[model samples]
Target: MASPHRKGSNIEGILDVKRDKVTVSPLGLDITWGGDSRYWRIDARYVELIQVCWLEVNGSVEMKHLEKSTKYKLEFKIRMKPDAFGWNDSPVYIMAMPGKKAKCIWASVDLSRIKKSEQESSLIPPRLEFTTPGPESFHEDDRMSFGLFEIWKGRWKGGLVIEGVIISRA
Candidate 1:
């Protein structure tokens, strides 16, 4: 569901890794997700974690779709439900690599910092910044693979809503 939309004078490129397009570990059995009427207007689907000890959500975007030589940031748009648990001390890592041969870059963020509210509200998630390779260094088929992970904790966690991953100019 990634698309380029027009900005005032320039096109602000964006890549949206929607729930359907993301690869979720332990899908269906422990995690349930799909489109809902509430998000119909924005054309967004949501992934909810029922219960899981290992967590990993991954997605990627093609470099050709982005403006060359420009810096971009990637973020996972997520929210924690009121009854969410097991994230008190768990630190999730956000990772990204410009291309298959590139070294991976990652940053850790504490999801427990997000305040749980009665309403479904979005939180300012952690971001990983990367610069698109210049034309001479870029390849048409190159891709930027990214993911959110909390696999080592091995503690049961639930009530997490994954809206999607957003990649935009930094």
Candidate 2:
């Protein structure tokens, strides 16, 4: 079973994107803010056709607001349900944007046998470490926007239940 998705002010990560701040698909998809100020859940119960029509998930956060000098990784905490599809044999696209210093990555997901809980969510490969630029680097503002947008080769995907994007370090 998956952990109940809820929201709390203290919850961390870019997962808690304000409704007005969400720039993902507003068409053919229902993006819901999991009834909390700190959770982003897209109520994508069904996607028409499930093809390469729309294949992008985008999000971001301010580096300055995060703990200074801390190392963190951006990951989509997802638990694949039994009916999960569109994820097999398809690679996801990830990109980090910091003043044009963007790092885009490709992620392959095999959810066919994974447990159906965020606790079962595995670490994305090619672990990318993002060190907070520290407070000194911020004079005007320092925002870091990263996302899993577009499927490799324009493949469409579906049936992905997202707990949220988690920013954490070992």
Candidate 3:
């Protein structure tokens, strides 16, 4: 069973859900920014993905005066350690107007660049990563906005994680 807990103005994490071949762990995330403002930033990260799963989220806020023709950009940062076989995979998705029947739009960021090699002495890099997916139109009556990165596949030699957001503004 997947159970989610809420704290204050933020939803904490999902619990009792299956991951990595039936292993259960809480997928709690710290939402650095989210609200009814003209702009929003959503971020999250995880180190495991070994099963078929999906994250479902909805908005309880309504937007008024949102400019027509405006566009929303979604970005994601996913980091993971390579499994013993050294491989990882995930898909980022954006649902137009949260929970709508429209097809999910995949983020345009290239996954091949995710595994860039950096100097060992350099600062530690954030595992999973992304910026808001971009260049899409918005309507005045479009009150709902939400985004997510589905961990479609992940297997590697060490560890893995990713982070990113859907930023909406005029």
Candidate 4:
């Protein structure tokens, strides 16, 4: 049960989505993330899921400050621990929406395979891409919602570590 805050850590309890680009830490998520210290390790940089049956991590960002008429990518920078389990049959999905009234876009990935690939290069983690609308299409107060979900499986899973959600120009 390590504290998610430390000296010089960029992690924030509340995210300022008004920035041009930003990273939303686990602690900044808008929803209640389940798991105690025994099942989760929260530190300055990331949140490690040691074990869990239901997974639902979610967050959102304001679209006003983002570049208008531009495409943006919302991705979860994550990796799997060597002993990760329950992901073989479970495919975690990354989902996003440009505005509150917009349709949602999603993509699925296998965490077990991601772990292998990450161990190979240890460079960039996998990212899911999504495009946003121009300023003319949405109001200034509109916000884009996004998250990683793996609840349908209903099986206990573990060993997934999440750095944060990166929102950048695509």
Candidate 5:
């Protein structure tokens, strides 16, 4: 595509998730008028389909009940830019997957003070594969899900821009 939006364009994009549908574009991802990476970087991942904030409030999609008694395979992929930002440190990507208990899926490469370029891959997102018990197993009648993503720079931080998709099948 046209690379979405140019950096430092003072624009914000969003991801709209709907039933049987998911769309992702670009966002400002930073507080600066120009999307500049000073300390923080970018990270993107996908998770199981759950209650989308926008669609839920508008009643655009029916709340499908997930049988927690069954088993589900949740997959996510994450990536980050090593340097381009004005950061002197290399940050790490810490991933978390929620289940019966909160679980740490994997940690990205530790750049912390490691000499490297800004365009390298500081965080190497490993293949995160996990399984979950169906909704029927839960005591509640509501939909069951897990938080898919969280992006940040270890020391100095700035705007975090991320992109990805979540897929679920019965």
Candidate 6:
């Protein structure tokens, strides 16, 4: 993976979200719910099958972290394995922002089709995006936040490799 974009109009490479950086919820608990940490070809050594209801990874960049007045995207870096099960019909959830009132949104991955096609995970990965405040509106502690959470859709989810999440200029 490459470093993040540093300028307003720059096209940045992937800002990888490594496995060791994940911050699981419930305090003091690890994110060993349905999957394990391992290496994959997509990116680096990361976690997988993170199907827990509160599985999350939180990260914040420094002041002027991204280019001012640029549009950036938050992507959930993951892969679909052949025996990977679940996650086809079920919707995944994500929450980003700096405060508690952040709205949760639904997301999905159709890896079943990818398995049949044997396509590279990099070709397409689930992601979310938001526009950065222009230089005028830029403020201190303006962090970009996002993560995948379990939905209350009344079923368990499994079968996905989470190499990391990335934020880059769009």
Candidate with top TM-score is: 4
TM-score, one value per model: 0.72, 0.55, 0.36, 0.78, 0.34, 0.57
Residue 38, candidate 3: Cα error in Å is 36
Instruction: Give candidates' CA RMSD values in order.
Output: 9.6, 9.7, 12.9, 5.1, 11.4, 10.1
**Reference-based lDDT, residue 52, model 4:** 73
- Model 5, 71-151: lDDT tens digits are 332322222334323233443433433343424454444323433432332212333343334454344423223222223
Please provide, for model 3 over 65-130, each residue's C-alpha lDDT reduced to its tens digit, 9 standing for 90 to 100: 223344433333344333312333443343334223224444333333455322111111222221
lDDT (Cα, tens digit) per residue for candidate 4, span 29-91: 632244356667777567778777777777776676576667777777777777778988798
Question: On residues 1-170, what C-alpha lDDT tens digit does candidate 1 reach at each position?
Answer: 62221111111233323432322221211111222222111222556666666676666666666677877777776778898889989998888888877779888888788878545656335557887777787886887777778889889887777766667766
lDDT of 6 by residue, 1-170 (tens): 52321111112332323332322121211233322323111222444553433333444443245565555555555566565655566555554453223343334544455552133454223455555566566665655555555545555555566655556655
lDDT of each: 0.62, 0.45, 0.30, 0.69, 0.29, 0.44
| Runs in model 4 lying further than 4 Å from the true structure | 1-20, 31-35, 116-127
Give me the overall lDDT of model 6.
0.44
Residue 94's lDDT in candidate 3:
34
Model 1 — which ten-residue stretch has the worst lDDT? 2-11
Which residue pairs collide in model 6, if any? none
Model 3 TM-score relative to the real fold = 0.36
lDDT of 4 at 88: 84
